[model samples]
Target chain A: MTGPRLTPLAASLPDTVPFVGPETQERAMGRPFRARLGANESRFGPSPRAIAAMAAAAGEAWMYGDPEVHDLRAAIAAHHGVTAAHVVVGEGIDGLLGVLVRLVAGSGDRVVTSLGAYPTFNFHVAGFGAELHRVPYRDDREDTDALVQKAREVGAKLVYFANPDNPMGTWHEAGVVEEMVAALPEGALLVLDEAYADLAPAGAVPRIAADDPRVIRMRTFSKGYGLAGLRVGYAIGAPALIRAFDKVRNHFGMGRVAQAGALAALADQGWLRDVQGKVAAARDRIAGIAAANGLRALPSATNFVTVDCGRDGDFARAVLRECIARGLFIRMPGVAPLDRCIRISAGTPADLDVLEEVLPQALRAAAG
Target chain B: MTGPRLTPLAASLPDTVPFVGPETQERAMGRPFRARLGANESRFGPSPRAIAAMAAAAGEAWMYGDPEVHDLRAAIAAHHGVTAAHVVVGEGIDGLLGVLVRLVAGSGDRVVTSLGAYPTFNFHVAGFGAELHRVPYRDDREDTDALVQKAREVGAKLVYFANPDNPMGTWHEAGVVEEMVAALPEGALLVLDEAYADLAPAGAVPRIAADDPRVIRMRTFSKGYGLAGLRVGYAIGAPALIRAFDKVRNHFGMGRVAQAGALAALADQGWLRDVQGKVAAARDRIAGIAAANGLRALPSATNFVTVDCGRDGDFARAVLRECIARGLFIRMPGVAPLDRCIRISAGTPADLDVLEEVLPQALRAAAG
Candidate 1:
């Protein structure tokens, strides 16, 4: 009469989501939020051409999507000025992280990442029974040198660092990141998550050779391209490393509309440029609102601005709760120091108007 | 410099796709497929309501899909007379199979399935480093009793059985399947893939209780709902087993448009019934065509018919090649006994007209 047996690794794992989506919160709250700016998604929607492509492809959904993702890969390769051999498209950076961890790290193998960076990466590493080594951020930025040193010390199989980083909205110059890449141990692969690369200032993303076997850079259409719901991302690496993904990935996991939409999005660089300008304006507006509320906003190069509440973790948590209570969906880091800051994604003017009105009230409520 | 090191298990695995999609073949041939009947996709297309829903949601593709899949799960639960707790939606059955295998069977764990039943399932088992013990089909149908015996003998953690099976399109009565479920070995969970259940005849699918812990039934929108490219599938089981998926699944894997499309498709069951009728008629037409070509068409409960080529595996392969060369897409099983048959999907009138014109020529070419 015994029920099914979960593997010991799975049984030991916690039942948790890396991030609680805003939709789940809305359901729990029994109402939708007035401002949705928590997940770092682009407030400006995708290009009209991309939307048209997706709508046009809707009826053709009767056929399975191309398993190889041929066209999208080709376009991504061309965009990066590389050949198709260096690209591997997947369900998103989240999906690709899972596959990447599974490919490199086995049970008990050591991996390194910045603490409070991205929970999804930790989740994947833990799900695979790999040992995780965390390095703390230095001055609100990912400590790349520390990460590289830790990997060497632990004989780590993989090391993860995100440029134009999440949570803190800080980044290192391409030259600094290039030096860190050079410092990577021979056996350790550097997973350079460039999810916000498109939004970063020039020279923030390193111009590495596409065939650099020591690093795999991941880019997504979710943020700057405004197609978060489509779940399309691609990894750029050596041909051999990229091809290894073929061994374990669910080949047909990419939706047909997703492929078409991403291809259309990639084709419209003008839309991307316009959105970047909009995001910059939105970020300045968010910072101005924070300043008006007597909060210090951290300098940001990405789509989001991290505001320092100038308080402890509990105080920052209270501020976040007050914002959520007022229907402003904002989030904060999960750990100390970084937890003292509240993260806010750049939203449209209307969305920011709601935020601007609520932040003062939320701040007063948190102070009380 | 050395590249990333793959895990021993990943290194040991072969870099091969379980099914070579027709799209890949078309790319190789440097042309679009004239008749896409190789995969058993619903050529009649999704419910117009579903297509409209997807198109409408296309503009809102900036928001991430609900990770909980709350509304769709509730709708699926209502349809199956189960609670939301009994359902877990995923990125197609292929993706779910990978997660299920990872959860239940670890490296060196035993899993049982019919040989050549589903290569995708085998792919997942291998990807997880699990040892698979396959029981061959008997009389061109999956031998459930033999599978049960093998599971018991090997102490298998999971056993996979597909009702209204793929490739052969043969099925057993509900009572027989129920008996097999009851006979499942302790600690073994039966994975009943009902991908084609909506098209199955009465008594072909068992009326199992949703709380049955010994079995997890998987259903897909790809077949009957005609949304193959959307990649939505759901697994039904006891609340405990269903919730286990949350431990390891990609939370944001399901696309927003896919959820909307599936919800709309489920609401329009009338469209489902109409598609079923069309599939039935197309199946009959395919059988008639086979008979006229001096081939024996097997009894089928699913969307495709398997025609015995009156020869061996090589002859069947030659016929399949001829069909492809004549600009018609058809497929055949890859293993022995079943490899002697060529499989054709039910298509629209226009698609069938192309098939009717090309199939006879294919046979003649094969004979020569």
Candidate 2:
């Protein structure tokens, strides 16, 4: 290659997409999807106030956003009962996760995450050339005991967990999670991903003290707030951990409109509650439909419902393809055992109607 | 620390602000700048069509951006006469620089740049634990010969230069830069930042083949296209260099609204030309104003004009402070002898009127 040689790591890694976005898949399939349920997006849409705020800021797209993210951080701090120093907002939780991993992990350092958890987190670890230890979920929930054991055994510097997790909407109670936090080794830091916390029931979110430094929690406006396309997410942690981001972060990364849209989304609690209600209703509709099709829907504390296919991974995959063929965009776990199920995100009533209509035909075709 | 332990490289790094944003300073002073010219943002905002497109996208803020950035990359490639594989869209030049540095420069690797060149590039170098070699500019233009020599002397893996550079609106002719590229060490990559290329004079932007594997050129909508706050910048290079970004980039980092805005902006070449004309006239206005203030503005091929302060760094510092105190958000170079100049951006006639009205007062106060 006449181009500059990539550092050994970049040269070695393959060009891979973490998830095939529905848009790309639709393009490949030469059509649009009927029911948009994959990617865990809130089809209920963003807060009306956020949309209005974004429209208002559209013309002022010439000035850079506040690099400190001052206003948004202040609101988030007040909401969480923490100081603004405890928060760091970025492009999204994915962006913040990349920064956090860069802050701590280097080549050869060990980082732990549950296998088949959030691939984006693992992607960040691999991007930094860190070694990742994957502990398989126990009975669909991330095995917290296994995670702590591996962290201690490997002397990992960071361990990642998500409450009310993705692909499989399974979670442990707050007490059990607190026990896992207690078991983390002295040198190990926990990344508690609460991306779906808003959709999860009360008490599903562990109420850690605002000043706790052992764990850094990531939350996003993308999920329950329905602002995924706006690209806003934040991390809350010890002030020191938050400040370390300044050393390497893209200082002007956030778009001005996004910051404004997210602030509006955060402030409009009524709209958020309205979306949460819709999401809950959609989740029930999906579970009910899944049950009617002879599959068991996993109890969910998140926006998405995971339905056990009552068959194997191959059957589940065939079912997924059938759904896609019928214009439904749904997904399943990438790994074994967990792949025996399909994950469907909460959506509008019309989107669910499309899913309900397509499910029977897709299942019959898969069976055929 | 109870939080994550930073890696040795990250720990050694300092919490440094590469450039204090004009916004931060404005908040500190509890006032807004009357003439906002410091950040090189086009006071002439993006096209009305681009704004309309982003506004239309406001409702779709619930969906994540296409991870492949397929449409935006295709549009950029078409605009630049290259294949889709030749370009990668990112948050901005700053974000792209962070990725490129990570892809090529590892711990203790050598990278070269002009001493007072783009500070964000240097920040990335330090963030990655790379050894930075600074070559002082020859007469305010990045000394091409000295940069190549430094690269060879230190076996540097990366060398950076910005055409129509910032902090000092000085530029090297295309032929001179082409010669510099020809003289680069075999293994070193050239990062040609053309962020201001569209605003430059004739023959300033080189006609290098997009497939040239030895160099990667960066361009942004933030300048001539007047979309700075939108945070869209792209790198055009050989397929190899572009593909390397896929390995570590936040695949979904780019915002959906930004992608929409940039696509519309690129398609509306007429709007671009109109803005370019406005930029030229403003540059002239800024120059004439500087001349009336007893300071000679350097010939600029950029939106910003660097006025020679006719004294030492301290005098330029005083001039800058006086301008800021008088509500002009102008900036100056960080290192001598370029520090003997203060940089002012091209703005609308009304914006220039403010500068014209304030310059004499600022000068008088600085002298006292």
Candidate 3:
């Protein structure tokens, strides 16, 4: 018998993940990478308190987590000086983006983002049958002016902007982002992704009013708190917009251990400070390695550094291939211009030692 | 200024949670429940092996979970005597139901279920703007024949049927369910939710062909596996249907610790057997308590029992309220007929002691 038919929209969509994880790559390679710097995960690890909290909550997992996510939201709200009504906790920024897209953009709706920005946002837009408009980055950073202009021209429903952007490790000043938020077209939502905000310079992240209706600032524990595997992220927006998430989100989605871990992680800001320091040192070490290899490292406000190969995208891709072959897990952007730079995350000193040992060899191989 | 405009369908939807969790109730009462049995969770707890695995994974929470969920899917597939291609794991059945509904049923598409069946399924259908057709339960159990007939009548894309149904904890024989599966409409997919399958009697679960394209069987660690807080569930279906989930699912949604815990939980079948025995004994104790209070406990193939209060829906609701007032967390179904019964979950002996003491007082108060 024939199987059930997929909806026309689902049938038209491709079966693809936004990012192929490092574990999948390792499985294909038949061995683990010596240096796991890809995926931008924090290798310094979560706070000891967070780990302890998770371990403590492990046995109590027979019960469902609080569907309301009340305590965690309240803690996050207190941290941001906003009421809990202005925040919504979700699986991650990735999952939240999916729900936000569903709540605002429908079939044939227009969405705007940088050409080489986060692919997951585009994935959700396409999954919902929305038309995506791409604006080219200027000076290796997301061009907010062009994005705003494009959104207005296309009558877009959503505009995705990542401060301390991925793939290139570039960021905009807080004032510039505030201006962009204020300039968003009527009826358009600005998805200001701050996934890397905690690692960025203080002045680089804009302080928007919690009740700002035009923008939703997204943050995650994955980057700063070192809880990527826990899958906790939240968005700050107007109370009404935040409440709208309840209309479509999986109520019991958050794992109880995750909630406990994030709560502990939030309470342990000292651990976060330690991670930030380690990330800064790692970034400096990565840049030094690139400089010694006769490559230029772009200035970054994130936990990663992007090293320009001083060549075309193909040449940089060859360098990336050599690194992967040498068991140094690294990634590069998909779109051109950005692709000339290879991205590497801030890992522990041992991981960086592996990278230091492999970089020259990879460059020589690519040159040959 | 107005916030970003919600899609017409999202705006029309109400802000609702399918189930009000015990934590929410506890918050309202400003104290913890003496006997936590409202959510049907296993107070017996997860396998010790699972707890240890989660504790081990906690330190590595810095890494992103495998987006593919490879190892867990392999383990699940091997347990079921099927290839890994036949399995798709997700963030529990609630999350999977949302994706399944999105894949097959779009706006205006018809979906069928029992009138008081799983509300989460209906929530997803409504979230996607699909029209829902619900048939009333037959003899307190889900009427598979009526659901299938309605699916054919309305050309429904999906039909939801829960084995050892929730709320009532009643079930049909495997032989009868097999006939209903074979008779499903040509274009309809049957969502066979076996969330309580492990607690069911031997021979009650029909063995369907692994390649059966008309049905997708959903099982969860939430109930019998004692992992509701972990949010792990899986669906077994034809390879084509299984792969289709990638189109819209959050690939990295499953937490790494959860994956590790479920793997260990699967390997420790001894723990599962022990839990099953505990569940049976707890069920007996719950029934005894009901009988002592002059209430008739319905025969349950699941971990919870529905006790008829020998009165109307309002009377049962009063009984439920009294139980809650006395700090014994219990729940009753929302609709008529089923509302005449109060649903109590199997709990630990000490928890049951609290229930045994308070239930009579609750009954007396309701009578007054």
Regarding TM-score, does 1 or 2 come out ahead?
1
Pairs clashing in candidate 1? none
Instruction: Please give, for residues B18-76, the per-residue lDDT of candidate 3 as tens digits.
Output: 88988999999999999899998889999999999999999999888999999999999
Number of the predicted model whose DockQ against the real structure is largest? 3
By DockQ, the better pick of 1 and 2 is: 1
CA shift of B204, model 2, Å? 0.9
Looking at candidate 3, what is the lDDT of residue B300?
94
lDDT of 2 by residue, B129-213 (tens): 8899999888778888998999999998999989888777888888988888889888888899999998887688877787877
Q: Candidate 2, residues A1-368: lDDT per residue as tens digits?
A: 55558888878887787888888998998988987899898888888889889988889898888888889999999998999999999988999999999999989999999989899899889888999999999998899999999999999999999998887998888988888888888889899999999888777888776576679999999998998888899999888888999888998998789899999999999987887888888878888998898889998888899999888999999999999988999999988889999999888889899989998998899899
After aligning candidate 2 to the native by TM-score, how far in Å is the CA of B357 from where it should be?
Answer: 2.0
lDDT of 3 at A133: 97
In order, what lDDT does every prediction score? 0.92, 0.89, 0.93
DockQ for all models: 0.79, 0.77, 0.83
DockQ of 1: 0.79
Regions of candidate 1 where Cα sits further than 4 Å from its true position? none
Runs of candidate 3 with Cα error greater than 4 angstroms are A1-3
